[model samples]
Target: MQKEELYKGMNPLEAAVSGAALEGAVASGLSDPFGSLDLLTIQVTPLAIGIRADGNNFVPIIPRSTTMPAQKDLIFTTAHDNQAEALIIVYEGEGKKVEENHLLGYFKITGIPLAPKGVPEIRVILDIDASSVLRVLAGVLMPGSHQPVNPVMGVRMPTVDDGHGWCAEALNRAYGSTLDLVTVHKKI
Candidate 1:
Protein backbone atom coordinates (compact mmCIF):
# COMPACT_ATOMS: atom_id res chain seq x y z
CA MET A 1 0.00 0.00 0.00
CA GLN A 2 1.07 3.57 -0.56
CA LYS A 3 2.59 5.29 2.49
CA GLU A 4 -0.35 7.77 2.62
CA GLU A 5 -2.91 4.97 2.38
CA LEU A 6 -1.12 2.63 4.83
CA TYR A 7 -2.30 4.67 7.83
CA LYS A 8 -5.63 5.66 6.34
CA GLY A 9 -8.90 4.78 8.12
CA MET A 10 -6.91 3.49 11.14
CA ASN A 11 -6.37 4.66 14.68
CA PRO A 12 -3.04 6.42 15.32
CA LEU A 13 -1.81 3.54 17.52
CA GLU A 14 -2.87 0.88 14.98
CA ALA A 15 -1.13 2.70 12.14
CA ALA A 16 2.07 3.05 14.12
CA VAL A 17 2.05 -0.63 15.12
CA SER A 18 1.38 -1.75 11.55
CA GLY A 19 4.18 0.43 10.21
CA ALA A 20 6.60 -0.97 12.79
CA ALA A 21 5.69 -4.53 11.89
CA LEU A 22 6.18 -3.85 8.18
CA GLU A 23 9.57 -2.30 8.88
CA GLY A 24 10.54 -5.29 10.95
CA ALA A 25 9.52 -7.68 8.21
CA VAL A 26 11.67 -5.85 5.70
CA ALA A 27 14.65 -5.40 7.99
CA SER A 28 14.56 -9.04 9.00
CA GLY A 29 14.58 -10.13 5.36
CA LEU A 30 11.16 -11.70 5.74
CA SER A 31 9.83 -9.71 2.77
CA ASP A 32 11.08 -7.73 -0.19
CA PRO A 33 10.99 -4.12 0.80
CA PHE A 34 10.98 -2.80 -2.76
CA GLY A 35 7.68 -3.89 -4.28
CA SER A 36 8.21 -1.97 -7.50
CA LEU A 37 8.07 -3.97 -10.71
CA ASP A 38 11.35 -2.62 -12.08
CA LEU A 39 14.35 -4.72 -11.19
CA LEU A 40 17.77 -5.49 -12.72
CA THR A 41 19.88 -8.62 -12.62
CA ILE A 42 23.41 -9.42 -13.82
CA GLN A 43 24.22 -12.47 -15.88
CA VAL A 44 27.37 -14.61 -16.11
CA THR A 45 28.75 -17.43 -18.21
CA PRO A 46 27.94 -20.91 -16.97
CA LEU A 47 31.13 -22.49 -18.38
CA ALA A 48 34.65 -21.45 -19.22
CA ILE A 49 35.48 -20.67 -22.86
CA GLY A 50 38.91 -21.47 -24.24
CA ILE A 51 41.01 -23.18 -26.89
CA ARG A 52 42.83 -26.45 -27.27
CA ALA A 53 46.57 -26.12 -27.52
CA ASP A 54 49.25 -28.70 -28.16
CA GLY A 55 49.12 -31.98 -26.20
CA ASN A 56 45.31 -31.84 -26.03
CA ASN A 57 45.53 -29.24 -23.32
CA PHE A 58 42.66 -26.85 -22.59
CA VAL A 59 43.75 -23.23 -22.19
CA PRO A 60 41.01 -21.16 -20.65
CA ILE A 61 40.45 -17.66 -21.96
CA ILE A 62 37.29 -16.52 -20.23
CA PRO A 63 36.91 -18.54 -17.07
CA ARG A 64 33.61 -20.01 -15.82
CA SER A 65 31.13 -17.75 -14.00
CA THR A 66 32.90 -14.63 -15.27
CA THR A 67 30.73 -11.60 -15.99
CA MET A 68 29.96 -11.23 -19.68
CA PRO A 69 31.24 -8.69 -22.19
CA ALA A 70 34.79 -9.78 -21.74
CA GLN A 71 37.95 -9.98 -23.86
CA LYS A 72 41.28 -11.79 -23.44
CA ASP A 73 44.45 -12.48 -25.42
CA LEU A 74 47.14 -15.14 -25.11
CA ILE A 75 50.54 -15.44 -26.73
CA PHE A 76 51.62 -18.69 -28.33
CA THR A 77 54.55 -19.83 -30.44
CA THR A 78 54.80 -22.29 -33.31
CA ALA A 79 55.65 -25.79 -32.18
CA HIS A 80 57.61 -26.78 -35.27
CA ASP A 81 60.53 -25.31 -37.17
CA ASN A 82 59.39 -22.94 -39.98
CA GLN A 83 55.74 -23.35 -39.09
CA ALA A 84 53.47 -21.39 -41.39
CA GLU A 85 50.24 -21.19 -39.40
CA ALA A 86 48.49 -21.79 -36.09
CA LEU A 87 45.12 -23.45 -35.49
CA ILE A 88 42.75 -22.10 -32.90
CA ILE A 89 40.22 -24.71 -31.81
CA VAL A 90 37.70 -23.20 -29.48
CA TYR A 91 36.05 -25.20 -26.70
CA GLU A 92 33.90 -24.70 -23.59
CA GLY A 93 33.89 -26.28 -20.12
CA GLU A 94 36.09 -26.80 -17.08
CA GLY A 95 37.66 -30.03 -18.27
CA LYS A 96 41.42 -30.25 -18.34
CA LYS A 97 41.42 -32.46 -21.44
CA VAL A 98 40.34 -31.09 -24.79
CA GLU A 99 38.27 -34.18 -25.58
CA GLU A 100 36.29 -33.74 -22.39
CA ASN A 101 35.38 -30.20 -23.42
CA HIS A 102 32.66 -29.26 -25.90
CA LEU A 103 34.12 -28.12 -29.18
CA LEU A 104 32.74 -24.78 -30.30
CA GLY A 105 34.63 -24.27 -33.57
CA TYR A 106 38.09 -23.80 -35.01
CA PHE A 107 40.01 -21.25 -37.08
CA LYS A 108 43.49 -21.01 -38.55
CA ILE A 109 45.73 -18.00 -38.84
CA THR A 110 48.00 -18.51 -41.80
CA GLY A 111 50.90 -16.56 -43.38
CA ILE A 112 53.12 -16.65 -40.32
CA PRO A 113 56.67 -15.77 -41.22
CA LEU A 114 58.94 -18.80 -41.38
CA ALA A 115 61.05 -18.95 -38.27
CA PRO A 116 62.66 -21.45 -35.93
CA LYS A 117 60.26 -23.04 -33.49
CA GLY A 118 59.40 -20.84 -30.52
CA VAL A 119 60.74 -17.75 -32.24
CA PRO A 120 57.51 -16.32 -33.68
CA GLU A 121 54.80 -14.81 -31.52
CA ILE A 122 51.24 -15.81 -32.41
CA ARG A 123 48.52 -13.96 -30.56
CA VAL A 124 45.07 -15.50 -30.04
CA ILE A 125 42.32 -13.15 -29.01
CA LEU A 126 38.84 -13.93 -27.70
CA ASP A 127 36.10 -11.36 -27.48
CA ILE A 128 32.61 -11.84 -26.06
CA ASP A 129 30.12 -9.08 -26.80
CA ALA A 130 27.32 -7.93 -24.52
CA SER A 131 24.90 -10.24 -26.30
CA SER A 132 27.15 -13.27 -25.66
CA VAL A 133 28.42 -13.39 -29.21
CA LEU A 134 31.97 -14.78 -29.41
CA ARG A 135 34.71 -13.77 -31.84
CA VAL A 136 38.07 -15.45 -32.36
CA LEU A 137 40.98 -13.53 -33.83
CA ALA A 138 44.56 -14.58 -34.48
CA GLY A 139 47.49 -12.62 -35.79
CA VAL A 140 51.26 -12.50 -36.03
CA LEU A 141 54.05 -10.09 -36.77
CA MET A 142 56.50 -10.65 -39.56
CA PRO A 143 60.18 -10.84 -38.70
CA GLY A 144 61.13 -7.63 -40.51
CA SER A 145 57.91 -5.62 -40.58
CA HIS A 146 56.83 -3.43 -37.69
CA GLN A 147 53.13 -3.59 -38.62
CA PRO A 148 51.24 -6.53 -37.12
CA VAL A 149 49.21 -8.73 -39.41
CA ASN A 150 45.51 -8.66 -38.56
CA PRO A 151 43.66 -11.93 -38.19
CA VAL A 152 44.22 -13.89 -41.39
CA MET A 153 41.10 -15.89 -40.54
CA GLY A 154 38.41 -16.01 -37.86
CA VAL A 155 35.13 -17.75 -37.05
CA ARG A 156 32.22 -17.38 -34.60
CA MET A 157 32.11 -20.10 -31.95
CA PRO A 158 29.69 -23.04 -31.57
CA THR A 159 29.69 -23.65 -35.30
CA VAL A 160 30.61 -27.28 -35.04
CA ASP A 161 27.50 -29.39 -34.35
CA ASP A 162 29.24 -32.77 -34.10
CA GLY A 163 32.27 -34.82 -35.13
CA HIS A 164 34.49 -32.20 -33.59
CA GLY A 165 36.66 -34.85 -32.03
CA TRP A 166 37.31 -36.41 -35.39
CA CYS A 167 38.01 -33.03 -36.87
CA ALA A 168 40.59 -32.29 -34.21
CA GLU A 169 42.17 -35.69 -34.73
CA ALA A 170 42.31 -35.25 -38.47
CA LEU A 171 43.87 -31.85 -38.17
CA ASN A 172 46.44 -33.13 -35.74
CA ARG A 173 47.24 -36.11 -37.91
CA ALA A 174 47.61 -34.06 -41.07
CA TYR A 175 49.50 -31.15 -39.57
CA GLY A 176 51.25 -32.84 -36.69
CA SER A 177 53.13 -30.26 -34.66
CA THR A 178 53.39 -27.76 -37.49
CA LEU A 179 50.22 -25.87 -36.59
CA ASP A 180 50.28 -26.57 -32.87
CA LEU A 181 51.10 -24.05 -30.20
CA VAL A 182 54.27 -24.29 -28.17
CA THR A 183 54.07 -25.18 -24.51
CA VAL A 184 52.79 -22.40 -22.31
CA HIS A 185 55.28 -21.11 -19.75
CA LYS A 186 54.27 -20.97 -16.13
CA LYS A 187 55.56 -18.48 -13.59
CA ILE A 188 57.67 -20.03 -10.87
Candidate 2:
Protein backbone atom coordinates (compact mmCIF):
# COMPACT_ATOMS: atom_id res chain seq x y z
CA MET A 1 0.00 0.00 0.00
CA GLN A 2 1.93 3.01 1.31
CA LYS A 3 5.16 0.99 1.52
CA GLU A 4 6.49 2.48 -1.68
CA GLU A 5 5.93 6.04 -0.44
CA LEU A 6 7.59 5.34 2.95
CA TYR A 7 10.73 4.05 1.24
CA LYS A 8 10.64 6.67 -1.51
CA GLY A 9 13.33 8.92 0.00
CA MET A 10 14.65 7.17 3.13
CA ASN A 11 17.33 4.63 3.98
CA PRO A 12 16.43 1.33 5.63
CA LEU A 13 17.52 2.48 9.11
CA GLU A 14 15.73 5.81 8.74
CA ALA A 15 12.57 4.14 7.52
CA ALA A 16 12.72 1.59 10.33
CA VAL A 17 13.10 4.32 12.98
CA SER A 18 10.38 6.46 11.35
CA GLY A 19 7.83 3.71 12.14
CA ALA A 20 7.00 3.04 8.50
CA ALA A 21 8.99 -0.19 8.34
CA LEU A 22 7.52 -1.52 11.59
CA GLU A 23 4.01 -0.70 10.47
CA GLY A 24 4.53 -2.26 7.07
CA ALA A 25 6.03 -5.39 8.62
CA VAL A 26 3.03 -5.81 10.90
CA ALA A 27 0.62 -5.35 8.00
CA SER A 28 2.47 -7.84 5.81
CA GLY A 29 2.76 -10.48 8.59
CA LEU A 30 6.52 -9.93 8.83
CA SER A 31 8.71 -9.42 11.89
CA ASP A 32 11.19 -6.69 12.82
CA PRO A 33 12.17 -5.94 16.43
CA PHE A 34 14.48 -2.98 15.94
CA GLY A 35 11.82 -1.06 14.03
CA SER A 36 9.84 -0.48 17.21
CA LEU A 37 12.73 -0.33 19.64
CA ASP A 38 14.60 2.18 17.46
CA LEU A 39 18.29 1.98 16.59
CA LEU A 40 19.70 4.43 19.18
CA THR A 41 18.58 2.79 22.40
CA ILE A 42 21.30 2.43 25.02
CA GLN A 43 20.61 0.55 28.23
CA VAL A 44 22.25 2.10 31.28
CA THR A 45 22.87 0.57 34.69
CA PRO A 46 20.05 0.91 37.18
CA LEU A 47 22.19 1.00 40.32
CA ALA A 48 25.82 1.28 41.39
CA ILE A 49 27.33 -2.17 41.89
CA GLY A 50 30.49 -2.90 43.85
CA ILE A 51 32.09 -4.88 46.67
CA ARG A 52 32.72 -4.21 50.35
CA ALA A 53 36.20 -3.06 51.20
CA ASP A 54 38.13 -1.65 54.20
CA GLY A 55 36.24 0.54 56.68
CA ASN A 56 33.14 -1.19 55.35
CA ASN A 57 33.29 0.90 52.22
CA PHE A 58 31.49 0.19 48.98
CA VAL A 59 34.24 -0.10 46.39
CA PRO A 60 32.39 0.28 43.14
CA ILE A 61 33.34 -1.92 40.21
CA ILE A 62 30.52 -0.80 37.93
CA PRO A 63 28.96 2.59 38.65
CA ARG A 64 25.38 3.48 37.96
CA SER A 65 24.14 4.49 34.47
CA THR A 66 26.74 2.33 32.78
CA THR A 67 25.72 0.67 29.54
CA MET A 68 24.67 -2.96 29.57
CA PRO A 69 26.77 -5.86 28.36
CA ALA A 70 29.68 -4.51 30.34
CA GLN A 71 32.52 -6.06 32.31
CA LYS A 72 34.70 -4.31 34.92
CA ASP A 73 37.36 -5.37 37.40
CA LEU A 74 39.03 -4.01 40.51
CA ILE A 75 42.03 -4.94 42.66
CA PHE A 76 41.74 -5.57 46.42
CA THR A 77 43.95 -6.78 49.25
CA THR A 78 43.80 -8.16 52.77
CA ALA A 79 42.95 -5.90 55.70
CA HIS A 80 44.92 -7.86 58.26
CA ASP A 81 48.43 -9.21 58.40
CA ASN A 82 48.94 -12.85 57.54
CA GLN A 83 45.40 -12.96 56.27
CA ALA A 84 44.65 -16.26 54.59
CA GLU A 85 41.12 -15.54 53.40
CA ALA A 86 38.89 -12.62 52.42
CA LEU A 87 35.19 -12.34 51.85
CA ILE A 88 33.98 -10.77 48.63
CA ILE A 89 30.70 -9.07 49.38
CA VAL A 90 28.73 -7.63 46.46
CA TYR A 91 26.33 -4.73 46.84
CA GLU A 92 24.10 -2.63 44.58
CA GLY A 93 23.15 0.99 45.32
CA GLU A 94 24.54 4.53 45.68
CA GLY A 95 25.62 4.27 49.28
CA LYS A 96 29.20 4.97 50.27
CA LYS A 97 29.23 2.20 52.88
CA VAL A 98 28.35 -1.44 52.43
CA GLU A 99 25.68 -1.43 55.11
CA GLU A 100 23.91 1.52 53.51
CA ASN A 101 23.47 -0.35 50.22
CA HIS A 102 21.44 -3.39 49.30
CA LEU A 103 23.27 -6.65 49.74
CA LEU A 104 23.35 -8.61 46.50
CA GLY A 105 25.45 -11.59 47.51
CA TYR A 106 28.81 -12.64 48.88
CA PHE A 107 31.51 -15.29 48.48
CA LYS A 108 34.53 -16.15 50.60
CA ILE A 109 37.88 -16.29 48.80
CA THR A 110 39.96 -18.87 50.63
CA GLY A 111 43.43 -20.34 50.18
CA ILE A 112 45.24 -17.05 50.16
CA PRO A 113 48.95 -17.60 50.68
CA LEU A 114 50.18 -16.49 54.09
CA ALA A 115 51.39 -12.95 53.50
CA PRO A 116 51.53 -9.53 55.12
CA LYS A 117 48.60 -7.13 54.78
CA GLY A 118 48.08 -5.66 51.30
CA VAL A 119 50.61 -8.07 49.80
CA PRO A 120 48.23 -10.22 47.75
CA GLU A 121 46.32 -9.20 44.69
CA ILE A 122 42.66 -10.09 44.66
CA ARG A 123 40.95 -9.32 41.41
CA VAL A 124 37.18 -8.97 41.39
CA ILE A 125 35.24 -8.71 38.16
CA LEU A 126 31.63 -7.73 37.53
CA ASP A 127 29.63 -8.30 34.36
CA ILE A 128 26.18 -7.52 32.98
CA ASP A 129 25.00 -9.07 29.74
CA ALA A 130 22.41 -7.96 27.21
CA SER A 131 19.73 -9.86 29.12
CA SER A 132 20.48 -7.89 32.32
CA VAL A 133 21.91 -10.87 34.18
CA LEU A 134 24.69 -9.96 36.66
CA ARG A 135 27.72 -12.06 37.47
CA VAL A 136 30.76 -11.65 39.73
CA LEU A 137 34.17 -13.31 39.52
CA ALA A 138 37.12 -13.25 41.89
CA GLY A 139 40.53 -14.86 42.29
CA VAL A 140 43.73 -14.55 44.29
CA LEU A 141 47.18 -13.90 42.84
CA MET A 142 50.46 -13.51 44.60
CA PRO A 143 53.05 -10.89 43.75
CA GLY A 144 54.88 -11.39 40.43
CA SER A 145 52.51 -14.20 39.51
CA HIS A 146 50.17 -14.18 36.54
CA GLN A 147 48.15 -17.22 37.53
CA PRO A 148 45.67 -17.54 40.38
CA VAL A 149 46.38 -19.78 43.35
CA ASN A 150 42.77 -20.94 43.57
CA PRO A 151 40.16 -21.45 40.89
CA VAL A 152 38.25 -18.26 40.00
CA MET A 153 34.76 -18.13 41.42
CA GLY A 154 31.94 -16.83 39.23
CA VAL A 155 28.49 -16.39 40.72
CA ARG A 156 25.22 -14.69 39.79
CA MET A 157 24.12 -11.70 41.90
CA PRO A 158 21.35 -11.24 44.48
CA THR A 159 22.22 -14.48 46.28
CA VAL A 160 20.69 -12.91 49.37
CA ASP A 161 17.49 -10.88 49.01
CA ASP A 162 16.70 -9.31 52.36
CA GLY A 163 15.79 -5.83 51.15
CA HIS A 164 15.99 -4.30 54.61
CA GLY A 165 19.75 -4.68 54.99
CA TRP A 166 19.30 -7.28 57.70
CA CYS A 167 21.83 -9.60 56.14
CA ALA A 168 24.54 -6.92 56.12
CA GLU A 169 23.85 -5.88 59.71
CA ALA A 170 23.93 -9.45 60.92
CA LEU A 171 27.08 -10.23 58.99
CA ASN A 172 28.85 -7.16 60.40
CA ARG A 173 27.93 -8.03 63.96
CA ALA A 174 29.04 -11.66 63.64
CA TYR A 175 32.11 -11.82 61.40
CA GLY A 176 33.00 -8.08 61.56
CA SER A 177 35.94 -7.02 59.38
CA THR A 178 37.99 -10.13 60.03
CA LEU A 179 37.16 -11.29 56.51
CA ASP A 180 36.90 -7.81 54.99
CA LEU A 181 38.84 -6.60 51.96
CA VAL A 182 40.82 -3.44 51.29
CA THR A 183 41.04 -1.62 48.01
CA VAL A 184 44.38 -1.64 46.24
CA HIS A 185 44.80 1.91 45.10
CA LYS A 186 46.84 2.46 41.96
CA LYS A 187 49.56 5.06 42.08
CA ILE A 188 49.38 7.65 39.40
Among the numbered candidates, top TM-score falls to 2
* Candidate 1: regions farther than 4 A off: 1-37, 142-146, 150-152, 183-188
Q: What C-alpha lDDT do the candidate models reach, one value each?
A: 0.75, 0.84
Model 2 scores a TM of 0.78
The TM-score between candidate 1 and the true structure equals 0.71
- In model 1, the clashing pairs are none
What are the per-model C-alpha RMSD values against the true structure? 13.0, 8.8
Best by lDDT: 2
| Per-residue lDDT over 119-161 for candidate 2, one digit per residue giving the tens place of the 0 to 100 score | 9989999999987899999999998889998999899886595
Write down the TM-score of every candidate.
0.71, 0.78
